[model samples]
Target chain A: MTTSKNTDMDPTAEPEEAAIAPETQPREVATIEQRAAAAGERGAAAVADAIEQGEDAEKAVGVLYLGIDLGTSRTSVSASNGQRETIASYVGYPKDAVSQKLLKKRVLFGQEALDKRLALNFFRPLEHGVLKSSEEGTPEYEDNLRAAKDLISEVIRRAKPRKDELIYAVIGVPAQVSINNKQAVLDAARESVDSVMLCSEPFSVAYGLDMLDDVLVIDIGAGTTDLCRMHGTMPEDADQITITFAGDYIDNKLAEYIRETYPEAQFSIEMIRKIKERYASVADEVDKVVVDLPVNGKPTSFDLTDGLRAACQTIVGPMVDGLSTLVSTFDPEFQDRLKNRVLLAGGGSQIKGLDLAIEREMATRLGGGKVMRCEEPMYGGAGGALKVAHDMPAEFWEKLK
Target chain B: MTEMTTAKAPAASALSVAQMLHLMRMEVDNAKLHGYAICCLMIGLDEFQTQAEREARRWLMPAIFSELKAITFQQHIRGLGLTREHFILAVFPHIGVKQATELSEELLAKARELELPGITGGTPVTISVGVGHNSHPRSDELETLIEDAETGLNLARSGGGDRWMQWRTVEDELEDIRGELDEQIREMRELGPGEESDAVASWGHALVRKIVDAFAVVEPSASLNQVRSDVLAIVSSEVDRWRDLATIRQLSEREKTIDLLERRITKLTGSLDQTESELKRIASLKAIDTGISSIYSTVQGLLDGEDNTEAKREMLKDIFEANLALRQ
Candidate 1:
């Protein structure tokens, strides 16, 4: 039984002794046992009081479940309290007191940070859907870890959980995040939540939509595209594939094409990314995508329709190749079922006519197949995580906490 | 005399004024929800109040309506007949004030070229046009748009007709008030101490009256509310600046206590980090008394689920085992 009250630390205890006492000191062990017993008694008393008052025990212990999709580019959260929010995966600290006063903030997140980067010590803590560094104790790692913690805290704040409600969060990480990176994410989230858990991003999406059987979910994120095969049970390592051919890849390719096609047109990766988000399509015919770029410091319109489409098309082949591997390796009888029920999701999945494009590619290579886009691609992972948090047994959450 | 009706019009028929207003309301609601621009134009004949035969007026109305529709059809504008000589045109989803004004001018020019049989030879039928637009429509702004178009129409009619006018917005009125206030404040500062107080008092009264007059034109909105709060905040801040020395000294002492408490909390938090394991144990125990409980208490509770109950239970079990292993 978890109590709402936090255990206090003895201020006079030496840090070195505190760190090493758990292993060597019987007295310390006895103290821990005594505290745990006291906590158990308190929990029992709370539940008994609630029962005596004829109130639901669970309602008396208010808990808000949160499902978070911590992506390389954006972090989204869906709360049991019916709040949903997403912020860009960027954290910025003002460079100095002057910058802080000018910005009127100690730290900024998301687009505001990007817009005011000149005065900010900016950090995008995640790369390739995992913490950028795995080595412990290095200054770079510590800074990034701090940024990740702050980013998580800001996102949870946006979820607007009631102060009286305990926060139980389930964060969706990339399918193949290393154990160390997973630990780092847990460490970051634990600071902001009472209980936290990690699940694979693609699995959460599939679970959220209840398409668990013979469904292949392709989550196209900013840093990686994760393909997971769901077969009515938990997915194993063999069931998930990740590729770097994703949103950032398309932005880079579009930037390359623009530089090649219009030598004088000046554009940044940010500008190219904005254009890709607005006009990314792999269809045969699309509306003309004319974007303005600086030419000799003058704004000039350049036609990027073909370049943008071509750049977007670059991902389809790799995606289908990954899909081919998943389908070919599956049991022969369910391979077709898997192929026909492909689900496209995530921010990159919002590309115009991507489902049809994926279907067309599948038809060419694997006879014929159908692909469906999630209704809310951006919220799918977080929403699924929320569902997982909700359905998780109370005991499991207690143990995790 | 014309009767107002609120029903769908035939392919060649225009909507009645009442019907148009209803449709405009719906369109304005959509625009507000979707964050788009919409414009309305009020068009009326300039100086054609001759007691023309009722037959002549009736004959002239549809022909003029069809011509106006033709001029606007390429732009997907909708028209409503207010009277035999007056009509309203609505352009929506993306049209703004400038575009609506241009459309009004185009309609006026096209109306001048019409050769009706009932009219005297070689004398063109000139029309007055008024345009109003909202780039970001809100629930309260629909009526403002209509009133603006009506006001512009009246202005055009009074200016000898055959012209288009756009009504000034409340924002424009607010800008004027701001300008006047700035000037008055500067003048008051230049006055002697005694005169300055009198001037400030008079200026404050005038400023409140001006704000009241400007805001009375439209219903209170978020932006207007923000302005009101800003004014209140400035006044409060000024009052605080002039507080007595004793009260200010007491507030300073309280602030110092607050700072000390904050620093103590920070120090306590630093020590709390040393007892991470102890805190974890407490947290795990705390979970025993769930603050907000999950919908289900145990795995068996999922048995009655309508779909995929078995699969969900297995998945839940798998997730729990994985998480348990990680926690360990």
Candidate 2:
């Protein structure tokens, strides 16, 4: 392995495998005696050590609180393995009546539940974050909560917490989760955990980033683009705003535009999103992007260069306008700080020309400052919670519940 | 050993810490997704869960590829450059737990078209989250913030599944009462137990005085008895679980003879018995008679609790002679 050259040497073989040296190795008695004695002692000691370890291996149970991040698209559960993430967040659901009878369970969770969604009801429970009926105390609303409760409970049970472990949680709420809807989710969550607390989605990202200082976070989400301003320690009414113009907005616009251009183009919303993700750009690059769209049940190609950019840029105007005002509300001096220190922490920041666009707009307003994106958007929020859990004194947790 | 190459994980379960991170990030990207906090459960599935090398590689390969993904975090460890965030970890799930936690695969495949802001690649970004208040509350908004996230994770564990959550629960109500009871019970630890009960029987103690002692009757018990009682209680409450812990510990030890023999045969995974036999065989070579074998026997005897310490020391000389005789 060291030299690339194949050096053939063998001890448990004939003379050809290994050359006998002119000077043979003298099997020293004294050294062999020493090793024998040492090995003897070591073996005895190893036995004693093993016995001791066996006796001490009994696991002691302690009360541990857990936090779960169950996003519509994926799920993550946290508990103490030194600190959080002690188990994989997963649930298992029976695929059919036969499966249900065989398994004697309704649903599984995490990867197990997710991978087999097609065979089950696959209820995400939240459509655009609230009951589609848009009313409170309805049956669909209640069924959703019940389903959510079942899923969460299974995920928690998977964590295998002690009977003595005091489990509590704080959940991240979408910025636009209506007060009634938020309360309903909280009420449902209340059934599963010992305690529950709610905070904003973008704010959670902001909090994760330690962006407590003046900063702006534009969380570009599926159904919405939320702009939040953090001044001092917490977000106030004027500090945050959620607009229905994020990824989903772009998808809808892109679908409409593409459909307008090619009436026979066979495509779903997902296809357009893929096309946008591949070719959509806000910067002035007019390169053509060719994609296959199903035409009358067959595939056809189209060049969507200008249209992609136009669609991708749709959310920018509203988001920029909202964040601009939020920035201006801060003191003039702090506005400069906020603009320059603009921290784009959500999925929206992944847009190719987003940072540039924000930088350009902010530069015109506050002279010159840069907009930065978080490196790990996936864990940006959870990592913040972990950071808080690790850094804060244990006693601090005692007072929060 | 077969030299067949295998991917770093099984095709079915591609779970890893890095994948968890990517998924959580994708949740943050969802447009309609709202939550108070987030939680991520990262399992070191590589070394622990992998039953076969082929399956192990399959699970681990995606992570290597994800790390090699041309965007975001890949810039830090390799290829293009990006600065480390002071080696910090972030928790971003507190606000959106109430809504959008149960993002479907239907959604993930079409996230970009759905205009879901979070999903960058085809990989879905859903986290099973629950919302709850911290049992140990803190006034610092940051502490409260963490408490909310922690509670959500707890709920997720307990079945606050598929979707996000953001609120306190009925269980929270009970814990509040328990917290108050604990506070009251703290004052009682000061007054000793059995002595107070004795005084009460003697008609010299007040009811309040006895109540002030947390365990007036049990406190006077012997320490050994206390330990036995505690162990028994653990076994009783947990039933087979606490009892099975002892057995699992026993299995983790290397004292099993079969295991030793296998390790010796394989050259990498043998146990103590094989080592003893190998040593005895080597010691029977020329110039060395059975003297080295005697030493091995002595060592084995010591392990068997032989009390002949002085005789064992003297036997060392004969063993040394046998070793020297073999070399010459």
iRMSD (1 decimal) for each model: 22.5, 30.9
> Which candidate achieves the best DockQ against the true structure?
1
lDDT tens per residue, model 1, A214-267:
999999999999999999889999999999999999999998998888999998
Query: Per-residue lDDT for B1-328 in model 1, tens only?
Result: 1111112121333443335456557777777778777776666776666666333444444554555556556677654333322444443546777777777787777777765654535567777776777752332255666666766676677667888877564335445545554554555456343443444555556666676677678788999888877876675455444444434565676567657655655554544443344435534752453232333221212435448887887888887788777767
Q: In order, what lDDT does every prediction score?
A: 0.72, 0.46
Q: lDDT (0-100) at residue B106 of candidate 1?
A: 79
lDDT of candidate 2 over A145-165, digit per residue (tens): 776677667545644554534
TM-score of each: 0.53, 0.44
Provide a comma-separated list of chain B TM-scores, one per candidate.
0.45, 0.21
- Against the native complex, each candidate's DockQ, computed on alpha carbons, is 0.05, 0.01
Query: What TM-scores does chain A show, candidate by candidate in order?
Result: 0.85, 0.71
